[model samples]
Target: MRNFIILFKKEMKEGARSGKWVWLPIVLMVIGISQPLTNFYMPQILEMAGNLPEGAVIEIPMPSGEEVLIGTLSQYGTIGTLLFVLAMMNVISHERQTGALAFVMMRPVSAFQYMASKYVAQLCILLISLAASYILTWYYTNILFDHVAWTLMLASLAVYSLWIVFLVAVTLFVGTLLRSSGGIAGVSVVFLSVISLLTTLLPKYMEWSPGNLRAEASNILLEGEWGSSATLVSLSTLALSVLFFGLAVYMFKKFERFGE
Candidate 1:
């Protein structure tokens, strides 16, 4: 445990020096700001596109501030998963290349402790980004909408956070297994795209699939209701995250440490 804590601090310091620590928060803030701004202007943009011709009429419901906030979260949050993957792709690769892992492994630290510390560090970054974005979403929505369901909105974000976890787990697994950052990022993108395609083509699996979890969260946010099916989806995502992260740990052990 002491070794893990020491390694964790080392990982955190490397993260700061690498400038990776700044990227997630910047990405989150950008998405957070874009949400309310777009929501505030969407109606005007639509109106400028002009009304229907002749007797035809169109009535588009204006998105509430909550809807805007949810939109921003869901829209950019999905894309933001890739940022986590890309940013963390080199966590182990760099250590191996730089001989840093050799120096650490020469000490009392075991490979598992090294791997687990990296996992925890990346997980912390992911949670921080998601929590910051969601909280900002709620704040901005409240500013624009005036009336908001704080509990439900925050609950919805918590549920959606599982998808971000799953994404990070898979990316960490890839980073540990692959030899290069580009390889890690490429494999992650391909894997996620394939998972997305399979889920869409085989809609039967949608009920308990991680791919559906994000979209389900969006629906819950928009409708302001928590369906039992959505809860099941969240459970499945959590399970997958645990399973994948466990696999990452196992893979990290299999790798020959630097200088070994």
Candidate 2:
């Protein structure tokens, strides 16, 4: 417990120094807030950009708050996911390259404690950034569009966080297995993309895939109810997170053994 806390604090400090504390949330806020703004001003934007006749006005129906939020989430599914993968790509790789990992392992720290600290710290920063971005977007959504229920908004956030959790676990596992940051990011992105494609191609078989987390979150926002599919996705995501983290620990232990 003591070692975990110390490692956690160290990880947090490293995150702060790297500016992960500042940049990611701000970038995501920009991405999130842009959705409602663009949707609300589509007609004006179109008029300014297009050389249409004076009497001809483009008519675009304003998206509902729920749709606006989902649009924000779609942005997250692409740009945000890429950003997150980039942010975490070097987390473990840097430590290994600098021999910091070896120095830390020479101490009394166990593999689980070391990896868990990294896991928890990264997860906290990512989740908080995502929440801030989503909440700010939700606020703008209410003002610009129809009001979204707080219960529904928060429920969707929780549901979507599970996807990030799974992502982080996969990242840690890959980091432990691979020595290069580019390899880590490439493998992680490819894996995520493949799973998402599989989910799209085989929806019936891949119903419980973590890739379906965004859709489930959108469904929660639009429908405002927890169905069996939502529950299944949640459980499967949690189980996969644990599994990946465990593999990371085992992989890290082997690295430690091999180094000795």
Candidate 3:
């Protein structure tokens, strides 16, 4: 426990120094804010950009607050996910490449502790950034459209967070398995893309996949419920995260010795 705490703090400090603490939330906030603002001003924006006749009137219906919020989440599903995977792709691999893992291993720290610390620290940053972005989006959504239930929005955030956590676990696991950051990022992105495509194309069978979390998040926003399948998917995602973390630790323990 003490070793985990120490390593967790080290990871936090590394994140802070990397400017991830500042820029990641900022990027998410921008994505959140843009959705509502664009939806609210679509008519005016169209008038300015569309070169239509002077008498032609555009009557675009404003999207519901729920839709805007869901759109914001979709933005995170794409750009935010990519950013997180890219940022964390080298967490373990870089240490191994630099011979830092050898020095850390020489101490009393176990591989599980090391891997858990990285996962927890990265998960913390992801949650904080997503929370800030969601809150901002909710605020703007209320101003532009109808009020979204706070409880429902928060629940959606929690569900969606599980997906992000799963992504983090996968990133770390891939990092531990692969030495190159580019390889980690490429493989992670490809895996995520394939999962997303499969879930979308085969919702019945893939309902319990982590990739369904995004759809569940949108469903929660739009209908305030995710039904029975959400529970199954959430549990599966949580279990997968734990399994990935364990795999990462096992891989690190096996391969870290070769770094020396």
Candidate 4:
């Protein structure tokens, strides 16, 4: 526990130095805030950009707060995910190349402790960024669109965050398997894309897929209640996260043995 805590703090400090502490939240906030602003001003934007006949006004209907949030989430699913993968791609690989990982492993820290610390630290930053983005987006939604209940917004965020958890777990697993940051980023993106593609092509079979987490979150916002499907997906995501972390630990142990 003590070793894990120390490593976790180190990871956070590293994040600060790497500028992840600044850029991620800022980019996500921009992405999240843009949705509401864009939806609220679509008519003006169209009028200014479109070379239509004079006095021809565009009647753009405003979307609900929930809908705006869903747009924010879609941004997270794409750009946010890519940034996260890039941020984490070199988490371990860079340390290894620099011999920092060797020095750390030479101490009393075990593979489990090292991997756990990295996992928890990265998860904290990503989740916090997502929360900030969601909250700002929610605030804008309330201002520009209909007033969505705080309970619904919070509930949807909680559900949607499971996808982030699953993402970290898989990325950690891939991080352990590869030494190149570029390769890690590439493989992680491909793996995530394949999962999403499979879920879309085979929804009936992939009902419990983590890729459906966004839809489940949207459902929570619309229904304002935790549905059975959300429960299943959340549970499945948690289980898979644990499984992937365990695999990462095993892979790290093998690497340690080879280094010895």
Candidate achieving the largest lDDT: 2
The TM-score values for the models, in the order shown, are 0.86, 0.97, 0.96, 0.97
Q: Write the per-residue lDDT of candidate 3 for residues 122-211, one digit (tens) a residue.
A: 999989999999999999999989999999899999999998889998898888878899999999998988988999999889878999
RMSD of each: 3.4, 1.2, 1.7, 1.2
Candidate 2's C-alpha runs over 4 A off are 258-260
**TM-score of predicted structure 2:** 0.97
The residue-by-residue lDDT of candidate 1 on 5-44, one tens digit each, is 9889988888889887787788877777777766666766
What are the lDDT figures for the candidates, one per model? 0.76, 0.93, 0.89, 0.91
Backbone clashes for every candidate come to: 0, 0, 0, 0
User: Against the true structure, candidate 2 has what lDDT?
Assistant: 0.93
Q: What TM-score does structure 3 among the candidates reach?
A: 0.96
Whole-model alpha-carbon lDDT for candidate 3:
0.89
The lDDT ranking, best first, is 2, 4, 3, 1
